[model samples]
Target: MTTTQTFGELDHPSRLLMGPGPINVHPRVLRAMSVQLLGQFDPEFTGYMNETMALYRQVFQTQNRWTFLIDGTSRAAIEAALVSVLAPGDDVVVVNAGRFGLLLSEIAQRCDAKVTTVEGEWGKVVDPQAVEDAVKRVRPRLVACVHGDTSTTMAQPIAAIGEICQRYDALLYVDATATIGGMSTPVDAWRADIVTGGLQKCLGGPSGSGPITISDRAAEHINGRKHVEAGIATAGSVAGNGRRIASNYFDLAMIMDYWSDKRLNHHTEAASMLYAARECARVVLEEGLQARFARHAQAGAAVVAGVEAMGLSVYGDKAHKMTNVTAVVIPPGVDGDRVRARMRTDFEIEIGTAFGPLAGKVWRIGAMGVNARKHAVLTTLAALEAVLRGEGYGFTAGAGVDAALGVFS
Candidate 1:
């Protein structure tokens, strides 16, 4: 006779989660996820979604009336934003500084948008003046850039680029998934029309939830294609046939209507993930945006100081380094993966490996969100110093921690 094995939570495994995303979740978020489920259309749940939207608006620093979760990971949010805006043969210029920007251009191409690019080296940021000059030359329909490209630990300047797009009458879109919440992103001041981010990075939550905010200007352009159900779209609500929307799932026109007074159906919202995203935003506001930025700023500085004290050099322009993550050049003769593995198993600590050309050459270290604290920063430094020493690198013991402590002091 065949027997069934007992299934339980014990069967699960745990990870240190020191990579690019899905960092260690706050305990409060875990508890929130354990709460009982509610019907998607239930009044209380709908209220939760509204609350989530309001909280994200404050996080995004936007007064955009149409903000909501995209119900997937960060890439899903990217697709939704690009697909809805790009029709066949539309022109798009992606300022490619790293992997994410390339991915965006690829996705836009798949959506049939004619794509162009201004490429930059992997550990370097795109110059705003170059982007402005490109906008004058390309005259594309949309200009998309990544605020923080984790693959390179570089943060591209967006303010002037947005200004250039404004002059050219092209919409400005930013993928801030790796930088938002951990860094100060004044969405309104920057003139970003569509901003999309993930819950995993900087937000102190798991993946599977993406929150996006779209300005009324962007909504107006998207609303030109409002294609709701024929029977349901009433006389005053529905637009002409030319205004019918493109993708049904990512239709921001109808999405805004559903999320707002229209109160129409879309999809089953991810209730637990929404709660986690809401709480993450709450933590940022409660701490005050300035204070939150200072924490990440200090921790990132401390990490850099610590790494330098160990006789290592950090990549990229120091002025352009991201507030949350850093890229340190891996010294010759030391195995990057071995150092990372030891940091994980021996110390219960984690650090990231670099990608692209910098892969195997730079170590990506993060001081982000909930992990941006004196304890995590100093501990990671101490552990790394020890591991590098054990691997026969000539370095003084406690050098990393001492350097970091000097900064905190």
Candidate 2:
């Protein structure tokens, strides 16, 4: 006999998240998500979608008319950007520096790109000259890289790489998911042909919506894959140049029609997530992007200062460290997992663990979006100091919090 267990009411602990991503959402974004849903094609709902597109254009700092949201996480946007433009056998040079950079390579490969990689150490940014040299040698159709890879807490320098891609007549694609709202990424100014980000990081929202912007040059590449659905195809309509995009759901050409005045039906949009994305951008713009970035910078510096004061070394190349996340070397003779578990259970605070080569060697602490504040920084530092002491890792009592507070002062 089998027994079916009945579950109790759904509830979760209110932990303070100071991690690489999926941070606490802004209150306004939460409220926006709770609003009543409207039909996808309802005039009111479509108006909101259009407004969201405008809002994200400002967030991406691009004048590209193709700026809009994809109904999935940041990786979905990455795949859409790559698969939409990259035909089978097209050469793509990927800058591999960290986990997300590796992800760019993986997705390009799935899109059938002839993937050539320029590698760097996990905790360091790929040198622009290296990327330029690779692009020159491969003569790729696209150059893909990660702007800020959370796993290593490193932000790659994109301006020079973008210039090199331009010189090579290759489209430049950047996964800016971790850095967009927390740091400055001027897409057009950097000469990026495609830029993609998610709501779960510094945007202060959930992960469903991915905001992406495409320059006219990139749009032309993507539009070449456009295909009218057979059911909706018109007798007089013409097909695009390239082969049909592999994934119908991620096809940007169809998504463009859905967002454009044509109002062509694609998939039903995730309306609540759209609302959340819009509110996320609204709050960032309300606070002023520059001020918001400065806030994250201060918070990140405080975390670094606090860790150093506690006698811990910061990991990675300090010059290329991200403004939102800091990686601290795990003290020798300490169980990193044990310390992190204690911080969660005792203080209800969440930090992150490193990935790949840095795993078990560093702790990734984040200060981003709504958590990029003085209080969040001090609280995380205080909890970390207590946990380290309990774990028998020697550190000066009160030094972490004191040093963090000094940054605010």
Candidate 3:
């Protein structure tokens, strides 16, 4: 005797997403996602798939032949990379600079790898020397770290760490999800064996697709553990000599064969997400990498300058901060959540809250993707100034906006 209520058409508020990620996507990417779906193996769709691989090669600054997309969030790529290459009992050294570093360690542990951690302060980059020391001690098979940990708004310098890994004969894996496209992640120069990113950050697209590049060394290790599924195997198929990778969906070796000329089927491809990822890379290259990096740098500087002018302190080592997100210390008497709520309800802007230790103590303001521009920076600072004033935090009127304008000027 109960009637089911019908919901109206789906709708959402138009927000100026200045948060850490999933920021305002580019119009081009949105349009790309609206295209009609195609069969995964359709010749034209496959051509687009090939193009995506080539496009992300330029985005990641690598010539690796194993560049492609993992059809999930950034963490999916991270898990795939770790599980494929790390057999049980393998050794991995993780540089723990912030929350994401802990994530790396946890994933490696789940892979049954013996993980050795080099812990660093939350708001500071892990010293390259410390990572090198760990590598020397553990003689690990792999060294993993996050390039930019938005949790603390710190960016680890991976070039020196990469050199250390190379000298010790360990593969380097970087979760560049927060830094790629917005900052320079030179895979070749850093000698990074594996790098993974998501479209939600500076790539100016939605989540659900992870872009990844793997060096031949890492690919060979994964191939050794490759096992084609029985459902799709032909007579010529043979399991590799090494242990089969632990996860069926995340096996990178099979994914490679799927992307290769073999056209093997794994999971059904995420067609719309593929469109979005491809367009995301296209938009990035169209803007040019260097210019995009400079834009993110300028936006971050503007936010820092604005907050300082408003008598707010920025968290973390300034020299090692990520160019995309700025962590601002919440004033002692102000309610941090109230401020975020007001920013959303009143001004229609969105900012982020910190994780773990920094939670409730800091606010993360992102200037990423299509929002990393002068207008967006100024608007956020101006709204933040109003909200803080309402919260009874003392600061000179217009100081924040004026300082941000100075950066743009």
Candidate 4:
């Protein structure tokens, strides 16, 4: 006997995604993804790939020729960058500021690198001097850092640390997942050797493709570990002298050839995701980088002002808060989760809860991507005010929206 299961057509309530990331994608990006697919090696498809590389080079604010997308989430490129450059027993120093920082150290350990973690306060950016001290003490082969960590809502100041890495002759790897399109991530200005980002945050797209840019220095090192797969290798293809990278799928050297004019096959590209990524960059560039950044900054400021007016506090060091997300302190005696649930059920909006040490202490609110606008900010603040009031949290009525409007004015 055969059995059949019936499922309803795809439908879900529209939500105001005021969370850390995976926020609402831009309409243009969505439309772009709906375009018909093309063969990975088709001339038209390869042209689109080349265009995407050029677009992300501007997104990363770098002239690096190795700029391209990794066909996975942000973490895939993170793993690829770490594992490719770091051989077994290589020394690497990771600056830990929040949850994602710990992730870096973890990935580096998996790469079999000798990991030295320089811990920083959860809600504050890491001190550049301390990083320099670690570099001097460890003299590691590579220094890894996160540009923006949403868990703490802190944007680490990396220019000084990048210079420190340069002075120490260590390759600098930066994960700019949360800040690339929303803020300035001038790779050359910061002297970052390798940088990776995703589209889910400020880039106004879904998460799948991880955009990466590699300096000549880092690319040369990654190329040193190059090994072509036997199925696709030509007689002229020869493996590099360095240790072979452990993972075949996340190999950057082979990926480079795949993206390069050589057009070597690594894996079939995610066609729809490539469309999304390309359109996302196009949107950012069309908006102009500085203008888009200012919009994010303004939206963040509006949230901060509104929350403060609502008699709540913002988490983390204000001096270094990320422009895309705000961690609002859950007032004493208020059930944070209950408030979040009501915010969803009653208001059709979604905010985030904190993780680890900050769990139950704060709620993260985001005004990013296409949501970084006056109306979205005010609407979220108004809905939040209603939710807080229903939860018996007292504040002057209309204060949140009023304050947010003040920011816009």
lDDT of each: 0.83, 0.90, 0.93, 0.92
Candidate 3 stretches with Cα past 4 Å from truth are: 229-242
* Model 1 lDDT, residue 283, Cα: 77
lDDT of 2 at 233: 54
| All models, RMSD in angstroms | 2.6, 1.9, 1.9, 1.9
Candidate 4 C-alpha lDDT tens digits along 1-409: 8788888988989999999988999999999999999999999999999999999999999999999999999999899999989988899999998999999999999988899999998999888998999899999999999999999999999899988998999999999999989989999999999999999989989999899999999988888766665356434434453377888899899899899988988899999999999999999999999999999999999999999999999998999999889999999999999999998999889999988899899999999989999998999999999988898999999999999999999
lDDT of 2 by residue, 7-104 (tens): 88889898899999889999999999999999999999999988998998899998899999999998889889988988778999999988888888
Q: Each model's number of backbone clashes? A: 2, 0, 0, 0
Q: Against the true structure, what is each candidate's TM-score?
A: 0.93, 0.97, 0.97, 0.97
lDDT of 1: 0.83
Residue pairs clashing, model 4: none
TM-score for candidate 2, please give it.
0.97
**lDDT value for candidate 3?**
0.93
Clashing pairs in model 1?
225-243, 225-245
